[model samples]
Target: MSNHRQAKDPRLQKISSQLAAHGLILRGGFVFGDGEAALEPSEARPAKSVLLVGQAGAAPWPYFLGWREQQPRDLQNPLDTWSREVIDMVAAHFSAWTVYPSDKPYQPFQQWAMRAEGLKPSPLGILMHPEYGLWHAYRGALLFADEIPIPDIHDPIHLCDQCVGKPCLKSCPVDAYSGDGFAYQSCLAHVRGTDGEPCRAGGCLDRNACPYGTGYRYPADVQAFHMASYAGL
Candidate 1:
């Protein structure tokens, strides 16, 4: 894939290099000709293609963490700020627009990933990546007015289907991660209370329990950084 693009296309390489400098990578993407079915029409624009760009492992954390230190303590949503700036710069360079996962009238990034990256859901409902498992995330996307030849999407290797016992379903003490749905209230209560130290400091227990992509798990400090933000600390 890399060689094919490098030989015939300079555009992908431009994007690839820009993202890599910040320790981010293009996760997967789709050419949104008619707009993805899951995307709310009111929220989506008439874009010819969508590039589902994101981080694959711990590569982006150092960029985020180091950048955060230079921000004011009272600065809000620093991670989102970092993502928006990085993606906006790249998109602008290519004469495209940027969208974020946390944007209002949210874009259907999950569907885009499924169509572009061949990702499936894990028991925790996070997109189960064959390589990065639950630790990966979609930071943002780039939308272009012109279509590019996107990589084909193959059937996702549903790792959760092959597991003996779904550890993520059982790892949360409150059973907040059961198949029914996440118990958001219960989870928030726990993370805000005294016994929440484990989760509050190092990320969700259930997410960490996933057996696949152990090598790609976010480093301890990075985990702690996000956990602290999630807990509003």
Candidate 2:
């Protein structure tokens, strides 16, 4: 798994700190394969390494909210828009290319995340973080023409394995998730229905029921925003 350069690079630290100032974290990165691995923009140089960027908990909420206020009225996909603008700025500063999860041709961000962070999926299908639990996300990434020193990934214990009761599977009123798998349509219906107010307002009861990382759980408004998006409200 440890394949990249072992040299200490200051650029990684600088890039990480810069992104953190904007409520983003360097989730992890990897050296690219010969000529191709990910979908690169046409204008991009021969990318040698890719650095995944993302948010943990509610870290980016306040910053995003502040930025959203100054944006034009009726802005669409405001969060993704903000993430792009912010990450793009970092990319430019560091002489890198920016790619997003929602980009055309759809970049393999989930796979990249797994490679970078060594995280596995939860029952909810979201990659469960060791500390942030389900409250983290991959926003976008920066691509560099030269491979940088990627830090080693220390695979942490999967939190779900330690939970005996598995409250996340039980808290859903509709039993949207079961041994058969997630009932997406059923979950959607409940979230948009009259009885879904609790879930709509405070987020997925099942997701909230997870015992790990309570301190990192997103705020109610943030969860509501995501739920609204999920239900297409």
Best by TM-score: 2
What tens digits encode model 1's per-residue C-alpha lDDT throughout 167-224?
8877776788775788988988898888888887778889999899998998877888
Error of 2 at 80 (Å): 0.7
TM-score of 2: 0.93
lDDT of 2 by residue, 1-233 (tens): 33765787788888888898988898988887665564556874677788999988999998999999999978889999999989999989888988888887878888889888899889888898999999899999898878787877789899988889999999999999888999999999999999999999999999999988889999999999999988988
- Give the best candidate by lDDT: 2
- Misplaced by over 4 Å in model 1 are 1-9, 35-45
Residue 204 in candidate 1 has what lDDT? 86
lDDT of 2: 0.88
* Candidate 1 backbone overlaps, count: 0
